[model samples]
Target: MAEDFTPPISQMQSTTLTDDSIQFENFSRRVLIKNIVGRPDGGVGLAGKKVTVGGWVKTGREQGKGTFAFLEVNDGSCPANLQVLVDASVSPLGDLVPTGTCVLVEGELKKPPTGTKQNVELRVCKVLEVGPVDPVKYPLPKTKLTLEFLRDVVHLRPRTNTISAVARIRNALAYATHTFFQKNGFLYVQTPIITTSDCEGAGEMFQVTTLCTDAEKVERELKQNPPPTEAEIEAAKLLVKDKGGMVADLKSAKASKEELDASLSELKNAKENLSRLEERSKLKCGIPQKDGKIDYTQDFFARQAFLTVSGQLQVETFACALSSVYTFGPTFRAEHSHTSRHLAEFWMVEPEIAFANLEDDMNCAEAYVKFLCQWLLDNCLDDMEFMVKNFDKTAIDRLKLVSSSPFERISYTEAVKLLQNVTEKKFENNVEWGIDLASEHERYLTEVIFKKPVIVYNYPKKIKAFYMKVNDDEKTVAAMDVLVPKVGELIGGSQREERYDVIVKRIQEMELPLEPYEWYLDLRRYGTVKHSGFGLGFERMVLFATGIDNIRDVIPFPRYPGRADL
Candidate 1:
């Protein structure tokens, strides 16, 4: 009976069989538009195949005197849209001829007539579903949009060519990051989002506390162990009255001192219980404070903590034992910058290596940056080209140059002298020997002077973080910064100070409190090795690879001053 059973094909939702048709999950009963059209030949080879596809109509118009409609549909797999022809009888042409209207239909793939734009066209036979759009209400139109304008409608910008390509490019870069680090034998470590170490600087971090959260906690506790009600307090007072009356009776009857003392003790106990009830009646809900400060012990972590600006300190603990380790995650900064380059929240790629020094740090940074660029060139060239056509012309060129060219290395002092010697250009910041180089100076070294990626090392000890290894001159630290053409300081790194007393003195000289760094110092006190590490701004990598001028455009959701849109 089972072998003889045959199922009837439905006319409502039909899909014809073809040997070459692209297959997708059948719950939606549709295939991705990418599979049907994104091919080396624009899917010309798969002519006459029957398949179902779903996508938002990028542009649609009624043709042939309203008898039929031509729709350009895209599912965001690639930039190209598939040409679709729908008859008026199959579905309402009015609904299908609006921009941003979602259409899912089953059709036969046919080769288009000669001299047309598309190689193949879909002759839609069955209109499975239609999501009508109000053309006037839709923010995205056929007109080109500026990057700044796109930020206003960020939720809808991904439907555009620029943001969608950025999404793909970002995905490729993230995948490449993990692949490169994993392939290099670096163990991936997820450092804490909330951390205690202020490696960058104090007061620049977003402090993590339970200020409001603990107040709610106190409210919950008060509800569970509520204050004494009026009725309960009255009953306790009545008990005290009864005890006092007994004590008075004992005194009037002139009873033995023991009896009188016993009555007095009962009265005292009743009054003490009443006092406790009265105290409970005065319940208040707020964050407990000690010495005019919100007590951190009552906070979530039981001490002051903050969103980490960098994972360098925590990942170093892992690198000491594992030999090499890297952390990739979002870091937060409370910087009040409204610049195109700054974000309140951004991603960081920090890698630490044991048994490495300043030169090793520079080499590691260079190789990592090169690998990221090459990865983009190999995997996301299509998206890169899209950016090249739309946003930045030198995007792909920049990627190729970084991937193929060797980076030039120079010392910090030498770089400063070089910048100072440039009589043609005057830096906004003074180019002194001890002063930290500004973005202009860095760009001069990389873009103008070297015309390639430049690694500047051995920065002033006073300007560098206390963790950096002090050089023999005792005036500078073993630090390095990888500067590129557009982004001046792409990566910053250093060989860590391994000596305990030297670092302790360095910490003191910087006027930093030593309590927060005890655990970091324990790595040096117990067993220390020559470890070096650097942090690469992951968003900057996206910026570098795509040649996008603004840092906010590359990330999916940009968080900055006065803006955190969903």
Candidate 2:
């Protein structure tokens, strides 16, 4: 026989107030709806207890021959709403009977009718505060709203069921990520949001600049001290040459070493002055420029910089020192993609482990993913249940499957072969050996062929990032991507190239600037070790957990192309 999951009202009635009640005493002066409604005792334990509650009214209606009203209120602590009964004599019933109206009331907890859905409800004795909302004026009403419509009103969407549930789920995942990494001895490192090195080297980066903000000042300065003309620059160079000749003449005349040194120093100062004049002469009426190049020295940082595409490169430095480290923060990409999986700004959880290989990388990725799934199942079951009830019915099952099952692993070559063999369905992208697997191909492997999470490794060198370790065959790199059912690729990782020569060759072969990566190469120069790491797109993870189709809806304040609403 199966055990009864529901707790009896009698069992709940025996509960007593504890530390949680004491903590919120000074701060809120009210019981949170989640505590009263979500308690195992069904709030029966606190029946007849006088408590103050504050929340926005979700729905309210006049009843009992128009003498009183019942308002369903939620404080965003949980999915369930607490029922509050207010009499017409207590306050203006009209003010308390509108949706979105906020209220603070002193009430007595009382048991609802035995067969009712709610185990307890609040009977209000005094209305302390009423933040009324005019039904005709409020934008959000008691109606079903599409996620696309809510994006326009991002600030108020959290009050909705879908967004609130997603918020809770997202929070749970972040907390779980920190807990898992910290428990495994991984140090959390804060990587810079503005970085000089492009981690992907793709050049799709948002340039961080103050030039546009100070365009007026730059234009004014340009007019006040216009850049020197070609003739002026030539004149300065001639003067520098004359100074050099004088210094040389002093040396030829067998003058004292100090006198010769003084002449040489004067020449150096003259050359510097000429250079400064030439630089000032090049400044245009728009952005500062020199020799047709955007002079970032005039901009902030004294060099080119951009919002980071990934924290992997910076965190790798810390990993080399700490042995194991991770960075969790917002990363930006300037891809013009408007797809369901892309975001202009999104968070990334990147973990780099020293002395780990591709296999170890895959294991860590799998384990961390499974840990997140289990964490949601354990700590956020209520929100998960709400999501299952509304958004995705299979969400809970999917979590269970991922949490318990070991992910399937295959080489990139094997995956391509398998994909090609599937003749029943024609793929949009070609399934060739060296071609990069598209989302369609990835989904087919995880959803159709394997029907589970799949880890594809040993990707072709030409298709992967330059930092990935090249295999012995020299044809492919030791890279891996973890593909799940709904989201094709959730995690991308690889064992870094530890050999100094190999990495330099890879960089040169890719035609990337070696100067930007000099610091990264220094890690190999001094103390090189076989290290592996992976990055999990945080928004994609939220989309997977919530069953929310659009990536924009999962994040609190989404940033996409031409859309950065509050």
Candidate 3:
């Protein structure tokens, strides 16, 4: 039989508990004193209202005559803080109740001393210690805690004033983003985490595979794919050279079609010989071959699978159908980079708009960013104040700038010209009209040149994504990157190519297999409209909003190179 539980009459009594109930709830043995702000109603302020509250002890001042412990208690409901004053007679707590010890304080709410900014302080009738706190064990000491040190102790960092404040501000910014998108009539779409296509096409991906990897099975896969033919081998070598510094060899290379075919035939024979050798080695190791090379195809998919670097391409497809859609999820990148800003896994918010050009994308990105800043400032006053006092003094100023002013916009050509003339810092890669802007160059442009967020557009075609629409001059692609002062390359986007033939040509020229991407190509084959979207690094945005410098601190469980701790 299940037991029926009931609360005691004493526990059910309405004692008019206020926010200060946290001061002495469980720590004190007998009566718990709570200091409250005011009446829960819209009646008179703390002066005329009879109320009881509790809070945590922020600081305790014990002069010989009387012990006045300033209790900073919160009901965990609102941002408001309630202070409680404990007389020596009532507070037998002495040194037992340290900072962070939850306590309940009960008293009539009364105004503090003239110099005290607080409106009311409870003259405690009782002080109860709900829990004991050890100051030495807590990371949050009387002195301010640095964000760098807090990175090593992420679990407990949120309990501190600074981190708690950041959480509050981040929550506000997130709320603002959702509200903004909702108001604009955009549908939120959840994109898949594990994807087959390498969206960025950079080929720098963290592979995902669950296929059998026994010695025999691995050899079988090699036999099916076979090594490159002599001609194919030469082509692969050339491709490698082109990516590296082998300009002379590439310039001198020349081969007829027949000669290339002959070389490929010879290479195929050589690959067959190598496969036989591998088979023999596997047999020597007493492993059985699953199937003959001629009988088996490649193991599974057309190509290997990997974590998606971005969700832009997938969302762009939905945008064509839904007209306006956005994907907000985790994106992976295998850069092997160890930086404060880069994360192996980070959340990316990407929104695609059909029939929208690069200009429309810029408008959306700016509006979205500004909307978040304004929302945080309005809803998270306490958190903002905490950050201003402890972390970055310019935090409020930056937020205000984003909310009030228009973002700076400049073409890539003009930006390159400006960089060349500017003497602040010299870049290794010459700032030419055609080259890609490195992260350093972007930071200089936004933090130094513009002194605000800047959108650089129309990058050289050779450097941008394959689907970007070509400019009238045919020299550049209709692409844009929204660069922030501290966070470079905050958003990367472009106006996609709408013409079917042009996209097909571009795909063929790249030499990537087309059979797998038939569906993607069909978008162009059928009705296609001008579309554009940008990927915002969610962690970087959180870093900016909270005035925290490290990307690792923003994520709850950070996954970086060779590090995953649960």
Candidate 4:
């Protein structure tokens, strides 16, 4: 059942690629450093082959009495850096000896000296380009930097060993995600970034509107031409009175036609000036509103809109028609949380199945997750090594364990009983039947109790979303969460409630407006087939795979409450 993209990945599982069968060539004419250094032989076998390479220098030092320069260049194609030897005649040693210098050179791949860590070295024949660095102004040095410092200089952190590997791993995972779903006969669909409906029914959504910009526009205009003061308005009014008197005098004296026209023009001009000043003075800086409420009619969308918290609802629409569909896109939440687990904006992978139940949903989730773990092991061991050396030592082993082990399935009630029965360790949150499971509870089950991934299903309806299918007991919903070590709940899913009357009742019981969801109800009203779907926080997958601690580090740009810097 494997697809075309499967063989290369599968082949990579056993041995390192030494052939052109798996290439990471970029569109540029220059060859990727990965294609050279990532080989089992580390380009030593390709000696005497002339090639062009482009990258930023991680460290450069002049040697041989300034006759040549040795540069450790990394193009971020891989975690490894290629050792480049540039002659003073081919390129200025000074220009190439800086930490952040950009170097593009045509060189012959040669074997390095015996006993060196590197297997291959580049002998440059000619310098193609050079972007010199001001070493004094450069922020990153050869010294070791803390992760907190890296976060502050996120713009340049990619050049570091850690972040670049993270970037590559992230790229591979994203590619693997699309490949897995597409190979499984699922269509990739795009859901909206701006939505009118809150799929989670939680009001923690970032409101998207133009009202703030509109208010800024007014304030900007006033700043450029400040509003007329009360004294200025009075002066304008006095001018208007004087002009009226002059016009009246001209009419009474039967002045010449030219004088009468001139007087009338002056009167009109004065009146307009007075009116303008009065209006300007009355202008108060504030958001325009009506009836003491935000006039959303003046907004960009002509109504209240928000950055989508999840694409599940929209993807479900596609699943109804396409049978199998998935959406991977950015989702936002306005939760004012400052924990390592929360991000204001993050990505989500939501898949909806037209004819699947809770069991099928669990099967799909398990398969997809296992595939991701195996994918990393097969393709990203090089980058994972970097993660291990720097962040977490158990990163690779965890991946292997999850990829090979079958996730244990248990009922939510059973999991609660297990937590309540724990005698060795105490939980901060009390174990209860109706309460939603917290991260500590989840981690305890996966890490302490089972020591493997676990699926807890049949959550209490009151603690779950309204769209979850009600169970036979009428108290629980067909909801499931896949929890794992390091990270707690990695995926949340449920069998959707497809009955129109039941959904309407549920919506009413939750005190949500039915008008906004009329279209959703129509799906059931017309011809609803049983469906199920799940939402996987993309960052959580990256965190789990990389064993990175903070949710912010895995993503390229972390957006939290006070930090959205690029």
Candidate 5:
């Protein structure tokens, strides 16, 4: 049934090219390669029409005994290339045949010979522009290159088939996410990328500071007033002792009340001045320090801040007010993980639903993921076919399975038991009731035990975030993780703890500083209602749909442990 759901290429071609033909008559604009050759008819109906086209040459070769050249050009609007036949009389064949050459030409669309695979070809009439490329210098050649090799050439990787397909798939997924949330009446909220609170409370946030840029100013200040030596500190202490002695002497002399009070005031001022000098003497020639702690008061934000790990806390405020809201933006982590699934920076789609519980959260996450899977199948089949051919063979089947089947739901205890009972494969990590599920465990549950997506809910409170609702049994929290094959956990969500007292207790139990989360708890303080939300890693979704092994390849410019190449 999934294979039967093919995109109507002929209809798409007729509609797009027909409109382009009319536009050419009116405005005379250049046509996109997708509109020209992407249709099921292979652009047969538009023959004889002169049009302007521009793209980089993928491959070119001299033909007809070196009198002309045939060039395969692509503009990245589609995966397909347009065949252009350029005669020697129009332009030099030597410059046009090199791979990665950019060209713009006026050509007449003509039907190719009947036996060829392409239905139509472009016959160049005039050359307009040429941005030549040196075949020896171009990083991308016609030969296949591994994705790892492509990372070194991030800027040019999109020109490759794999990267281009990933880009289109990523774009389709993003569009599907917005469409799915908006259609379901969720308000799109833009949460701050730089936040004061670490949503995960893991203390693994990239500190955002201006200290590096303002280092010179700090150094100059310390140079101007250097820290005092031990001898100077002792002298200041002596001054404070002398001031105390003067105050005591005045009190013992039995002088007039006003005169004694004046002496006491002078002594107090002397002691205060000594204390201030002693404190200034501790200043170092680096980031401002107070009591051996990095003083964030002098930083840009006047307090400690970091790139947001998640937008759940910020979006929850909007959820409490608006009933349903979602924030889709880039988030950062300071993790040094070099695993295929970890990234220093990535985008997250977090949707907060007010008046919902764990069951509602699981249902919403499953439906949203299914919507994305079906969207790619419906609109991006061409790219999907390319992925299926070159990458994983089961990618399409997996998409169809996830899109059509209902996810299996079970408690965390049951999931642990299922893994415990399994004797077919030995898990790398030991199965336990309260320990966090490792990626090996999650994959085994999805790929081996279930053969489908599994939603494991009600995890132990000790292993989950503090905001998750604590069950009445006091052992497990209302949390859930949706694990799929290949990718471990696709979504993590829970019904938020609404009781202010319980949340305070949980915060203390987790040993987290409560000040940073005061605003988040304010949602519970004022007219709190039941709410739930989940965060879906956008790159992980792409990995699942495309069967891409490494998460970095799916994201355009991946930020990882030591790599942020453009």
Candidate 6:
């Protein structure tokens, strides 16, 4: 008898919809985008209007005589959720409706029962079946779930409440960013992605290469199949000689191997050959020799290039020309950071202001953040509500805090002093006056010491960028980083070192080549002015705003190291 029995729930509801039956003209209320989500007050009260709402059905529940399906409908214009109740037995096309289908609810609007959670619920009149949805195969289950679980199903996350909310808030941040810059008279700029200059000065970068050459692929095949035996090494050397050089030109423009044998051949020979030959090879290849001088000719470009870690340097040049310029685009870092906060490729919003100093930069960052917060409150209430209910309940309160209070500012020296004296000691890099503050130290200062966001400034010159202006003491630079409670460091900035001689001397002292940054130094020689700017990790800011902890969650299609699944 148990084997013959079936679950009563399976027989309850069965209707589906698609693009065909969703008649736009028949929807009693041809709802405009703004009315449905943007402004509820302006919408003809859902109480008595004859309306039709169309969206992907979330779940359907049945209880004997009636059926209820919670419709998570969106026009993709906003994050507002419109719940439609379908008790279609007495209405048209109700008997066959199923969950997880495209739905068009032609109904009479009524306020949800006085005690229920939703403000308005559409009472279904005519249900249109336009497509089919299989419950078991559907991505979103009708059960309560968590964001962590949803992340594993990356494709389905966008349909979940937390992700839905994240999407809206992310959009709001983008809009706010543009609006803040535009209103402030800053020229919105788009920088190149495939740039020749590694703006961050950090060596970590994803090398862009074309398709693999037949010779390169063959070399790669030999390395993988037979392993590097003595014969394979000799064969590789022969191939290098035969191909004239590395497979760069031979490889197709669309494919690239990780390391071409030709490039590696030079290194292998240098290692195995005589001291004189090794020295000559190192010079010819421009390769770095241990305890030896830099070989210029061997350097690609007879120079160096890597993915930019920050746009501040490049954007600063524009600021010199435009007096006020901002760059909002992708920045990359090559650090082997296997952490949530660091991404190999992340978006940064950097603003450079001419004739401005540290104070001006702080004001701009604060004002920009505040404007974004206010914009989210006004524009993304639905997303905000969804996040509060599903992701983090404290997110709304945090945004409010940002809007109402001025962010605190402290010097790096003071931060060091505070950390050194703290009774509770768990710092991995023990707090010292001149040492760089690790992420743990930053969190302690921002989350515990201040109990609010704080900007720590004037870091020791040794740890900061070379362009930062040296302070009166000469040991510290006019650098600052804004730290939020959970998001450790949100922004890093400085008043640029503008004097030509000072910058040159600093470069020399830092042991970085004057030749590579010759163009950058020319700015000071020509018409350099007092200027300041900061680089804000755009994704991190979104994380702060939406209460999404993982940096990967904020970015759409994240490209972290060794992970490039679209």
For candidate 2, give the lDDT of residue 467.
96
User: Can you write out model 4's per-residue Cα lDDT over 1-566, one digit (the tens) per residue?
Assistant: 85545334323343355543334344455767887888887777777778888999999999999999899999988888999999999877998889999999998888888999997888999999999889999999989987778889889888888888888888888998999999999999999999999888988998998889878888898999999888888888898898889989988999999998998898899989888888877666776688999889989999899999999988888888989999999999999999999999999999999899999999999999999999999999999989998889999999999999999999999999999999999888888889999999999999999999999999999988889999989999999999999999999999999999899999998888998789898889887999999989999999998888888888898899988896
TM-score: model 2 vs. ground truth: 0.85
lDDT over C-alpha atoms for residue 398 of model 2: 91
Best model per lDDT: 2
Q: Give model 3 RMSD, 1 decimal.
A: 16.8
Instruction: Write candidate 6's Cα lDDT for 49-81 as tens digits.
Output: 676666665555554555444454554455566
Off by over 4 Å in 3: 1-44, 47-69, 74-81, 86-96, 103-108, 122-136, 211-303, 508-511
lDDT for each candidate structure: 0.88, 0.90, 0.70, 0.89, 0.89, 0.70
RMSD of each: 6.2, 9.6, 16.8, 6.3, 9.7, 13.8
TM-score of each: 0.87, 0.85, 0.71, 0.87, 0.85, 0.74
lDDT of 5 by residue, 1-566 (tens): 55544334442343444623522311335777877787667788788889889889999999999899999999887788999999999999999999999999999999998899887899999999999999999999899899999989999999887899999999999999999999999999999999999788788999899976677765787788776678877887887788788778877887889988888787788778778778877655666778999878989999999999999999999999999999999999999999998999999999999999989999999999899999999999989998899999999999999999899999999999998999988888899888899999999999988899999999999988899999999999999999988898999999999999999999999889999899988999999999999999999999999998999999999999889886
Error of 3 at 351 (Å): 1.0
**Cα lDDT tens digits for candidate 3, 1-566:** 88865554434454654533322233222223212333342121445434455545555555556455555665433445666666667866565346666776556667666887776666677654466677789665667677777767777666666666666666676677678888997888888776777666677788765344444666676677664456655555555444333333333465566655565565565556555554544432222235542212233443467788888778877998989888888889988878887788888888889889999999999999988888877776656766777667878888888788789999999999989998867687777777788888998998898888999999988887678888898888889998886677888888998888877776666665676567777788778888988888888887776677778877776778876656
Q: Which stretches of candidate 5 lie over 4 Å from their true place?
A: 1-28, 217-284
lDDT of 3: 0.70
Please list all clashing residue pairs in model 4, or write none if there are none: none
Query: What is candidate 2's local distance difference test score?
Result: 0.90
Q: Please report the TM-score between candidate 1 and the true structure.
A: 0.87
On the 0 to 100 scale, the lDDT of residue 464 in model 5 is 87
lDDT, residue 146, model 1: 87
lDDT: worst 10-residue window of model 3: 27-36
Residue 436 lDDT (model 3) = 81
